[model samples]
Target: MGDENTPLGAPQLAREAKDLVELANTEETVSELLRRGLDWLTRIARFDLATLFLLREARLVAVAARGPLANARVRGHVLDLAAFPMVRQALETRRARAFTEEDHSGEGDPFDGVLDLPPGHSCMVVPLCSGERCYGVLTLDRSECETYPQTVVDLVEVYGQLLATALQNAEQRSDFERLHRQDHEHAKLLESQLGGDSEGVLETSLSPAMRDLARRARQVAETDTPVLLLGETGTGKERLARAIHRWSSRADHPFVTINCAAIPAGLLESELFGHVKGAFTGATKDRAGRFQMAHGGTLLLDEVGELPVELQAKLLRALQEKTFEPVGSDRTVRADVRILAATHVDLQQAIAQRRFREDLYYRLSVFPLRLPPLRERLEDLPQLCAFLLDEQARRTGRRGMRVLPEALARLGAYDWPGNLRELANVLERATILSRGPELGPQALDLPTHVRAPEAPAEKLAEDKPGKVPTLAAVQREHILRVLALTKGRIYGPGGAAQLLGLKPSTLQSRMKKLGIARQELFIIEGPT
Candidate 1:
């Protein structure tokens, strides 16, 4: 090969340029591509060392290197723009420039400590740039003091441009892949929230009242209007809200739920609107809140009436303008989210007490929907029981379990003060207690007050032979009964643990061992 100063003929240079273009267009990761590019540069430019530095947040990081100077220590070396004047100049001017030891006379060499370059070596910095954007710089150094011919410099410049374009394409592709994965994960999460295939229960409601309510819900689902779901604690407001989301045009997107009463008053704002890093004592990193998570989809503010008065104004603004600032962040974020608010609290009474804002109530209740309590639709009991029992069986891997007519009659006799949630709890307990496929009235374990009087307690007790119950079974049944009586409260006075004469933590441990989920006791509601 000729010396470094000997310029290549036009024809040979053209062939070299074609090969470099093909190398730049190869489908590889950014790091791999940069490494291969550096190898090509060292070979073609007759340089002993080469380094590829990518720009990240105003700092240049050495991503790939080759030759004698390339070592593990040199890779990932970060350079400040102020220190690497020639690199900065090349990036700013979008040109290739050569520097020697003479250029650093009185001024210390930028690469002195980092590269430890020998005296009289020539270093050329080429800007990896396309259009007006400079992705980074490519630096090559030779062992000898030699100038790069005009032809070699031109070829290197062309290589830099092609490499920059490839880097941009790779970054864009990576972003697209990340977004696609996020969308798929969100879809799965929403599917779980809606309780996959549970939305169909509303369509097949046995009760005429429920059927009519489903019809109105479907009508409202077609619109983007705010819907306020009104009902008692266990009347299936959340189920109805999810049905509305599934029925709406935004069903394909996220269906995020945030229980206002579930989070503390101090953290509720951050939960709704999100927060930046260092926003609060426990907030170590940025978090996207319910609103941001539900972007381009639906956001259900469950138990919305429990929201504090101070945050109501901010919530009202978000609803009215679809814009809100994150906690500790002045930048406003706008989300295209459909609002669905659910509450058992009477907004009228709350407004009178000044506990709820009248303006927020008006904005939320644009199309209010009141869910009927389970007692109002006892005719649907049999179908509802079948669906819930089948679902529980599928979940627990215990199949072919059926409820007896006597048990159904007993269930209907009781006025469900806790509504659908109470009924679900009763069924789950009965499922656990029943040893056979059939769940009889005895299996129900209903509180004495709600037992059907027509069944004549003495006669019903005589009908079935009693067997000694397992210690675990007895304990589970007794805990379930107390929890039902306490309406799922575990701590404080009148709670299940207090009635059972056990500490809250001890009761919780027993509950976990018995496979009794707190959600089943408190929040499990039928699809109606």
Candidate 2:
């Protein structure tokens, strides 16, 4: 050896350097990779403590720690840039800084207050720099009155460079994976919005109301103006929102959505505006929220009326200024997202009730489109059934499934209080229950009180000559047939009332007017 206190030989340093490079290249998650790097640092440099802090939002957040302070729960904790002089020196000068108890160079250092190192411990800190940017800082400390070897210092500097590159790679991989997932989900949503009809052959609705609504949506989609969708629950506001996105200039970009009512009020702000690391107890890492993710795209705020009062002002600011700072951060981020809001709740009433902001409502409703409920657009029933059944068939692997004409007619008669969503549930359930290629009235099991609509001339033309059934006549026939099938039992399980999906009392009244006697019908022995 050159000297008794000499550092490791050049050959040994070279070997360890090669190993560190190999370790950094391994396929692992960011956290796992960082943990393993810390372990390797301990073995190679023989440090009593090693901690890694990554820069996020101009603060160094503790990501990994080891040694005497290893038991400390400092991971996910943040340290201000100016609070630690040694760390600041290392970062700004792009060099390693070492200090011993005897040196007393940093007697008034802020890190002295933050870090409670034991007496006689020497510490070394290095900046993780790659090119011009410092990725983070690495610290090593030992509870001994000895200085770290020159070779060890050199190795740590190299390690910092390697770690920075590794972190950048890992972050890129993570971003790619997240974007891939978002793209896959958006593709599925787009397919659904197109009604799985890639050729554009399927019509959304033939009803004049819906046609007018679609026309308006297409007209406004080319602009960056905010669009508000107003409709009753399940009236397909989300679908309309998708249509607008597809027709917009940002059609190729992401279309993110959030249901204000579905998420808790306390978390909505964080979900929309993101949060810096250590912003909250569980916010371990920096996350780009919906606004960031939807940059250069569209964001649909469904159930917008459910937004809490306190957040309304912040939302209005974001809408007006297109910039918002993440929670616990002072820096503002630009939001280049087109806003689309959809809600069934009456915004005017909500404003009058002091539950919503009128300015925000005006901003959102720059181009408003109101969708008529299914009951009002009954003319579109046949087409809606076809489109819904096609989707259900594809999902259930029941290809080429169809509904019987009479069943379709019966479905058009009911007042669908729950709108399209309810219709979809009913159709999916019917598809799952039916055994044949065609679903009939038995598969429908509609409530008898919901009578079919008046038969149009075309429907009457399909009837037997001179025997076109009126709405009342069809109701009577449907009720009488149900009674006969139930062996004239009028109430309870398997009774005429139950089979017809009618309340027992209502079925009895209909029977009395139709001249069906109690003697002619079997009375079930149970409560009506």
Candidate 3:
């Protein structure tokens, strides 16, 4: 407010501009974003009376106005711009400057109607422009100032520029989001048309985290490191492993997977290193183990933590030197297999307890990569959902795929116990049951907590039978249940709809309607 520049520094200005661009490129409605931007900017500028008026299709309507005297009566009382020479000049010039008497030096008309100052009143109108073109005007007023100062004039100009840039960013953001959405749709269209492997998971990710993973995978795919992927179950560890294999130097060869937990200890060694024909009873013929089969290629061991203690030693040896002997034969059958391992269990804990070998843990964890949990990246939900919806539509042969605001709202309210796998399944179910084009709440099969409890059995038995659980009721129960499950991670995990479904705006709506807040659930746990 004091300097010619706004309070924001160069870095802050750039960041705000970037944020506006990001917001503009979003799929959110422009009106909603504009209102939010206006609401926030009013506070940011610290101007008591601020109004944003733009020329829309040759007519100007004040879209966003703030401060005290902005009601119908105050706004309706208007002076003719042409009759007031100063107002006309400000609009015509398309640049920020004071409309005070100093500019004219008393050579112009009295400026009675528009510039008639109230007690201790002063005003400044700054033109909002972008690249030499006028976008709109910002009128800032204060009650205690005697006259518009030069410093105030300059600050207002900077403020106007900031707002204009922000508005531009919002528009650009909207376009980018629309393009991204269309890209997903295009991918689905290609999938359905070409439909080769329906089981292959489509990467609908737009989040930097996911895109960055893809980039890193592509970069390191040529290497022969024994990549150890660490993440929770249902977090797409297998998907990433497969992606690595598909992109790596061993892409032409077989990519084999062995779930260490699934096979027995006795069979695991035989399965991995292969058994000679005469190795044991009922050893019908010579067999090639996963390592031999994946020679000069990639071998993925899933749930590596669950591997038997005895087998861990052998697995380590094979990973170190890439050579193994069949169960019955003494000769070593060398295969150039690149090892990749995935685990959901805590290998360190297993090692400490002596349930898992420490050396094997070190060998596997040498090139460890940890995938982030879904809760850490709520911003990517909308994109993720859109991608999943398209995927479901492609597989099931239905374009009747759409996620209702309410379903998305309810989804955002809860935590995803199953992670991406759960999200995919829910989307698939919704797509399958979609009754109409909208794919509304009816399509969803959300958990009991996400829905209101079925109206009392007594109420159903007594006569007023067809009463559906009100939207408000469903929202209320959903909020409360998630609060309990997550211990009230209002902004935390256990799927707060805003956090879960990735629609903070929509979740906000439901939270308001249901009369729920963080405080309601924060009551002392001492009561019965």
lDDT of 2: 0.76
Candidate 2, superposed: residue stretches over 4 Å from native: 1-204, 450-528
RMSD (Cα, Å) for all candidates, in order, is 17.1, 18.3, 26.4
TM-score of 2: 0.52
- Which candidate comes out best when scored by lDDT? 1
Ranking, lDDT, top scorer first: 1, 2, 3
Model 1 has an lDDT value of: 0.79
Of candidates 2 and 1, the better by TM-score: 1
lDDT of 3 by residue, 1-528 (tens): 223334546575566566655665662675665555556555334555666666554334456666665555434333345444565567677656655446445444222343334543556677667765566566666554456666556555765676676666665677887998787577545534443322233243433466566666666677887788988888878777877776777766667889888998889998899998989998989998989988878889999898888787778888888887889999898999888899999988988889899888777776777776665444455556776667666667677456655566656665676787888888877766766667566676778764434778887688554566786787677565544434444453334654346465676677776787656656411123
Q: What tens digits encode model 1's per-residue C-alpha lDDT throughout 21-65? A: 565456556676676766656545767677888889779988888
| RMSD, candidate 1, Å | 17.1
- The number of the candidate with the highest TM-score is 1
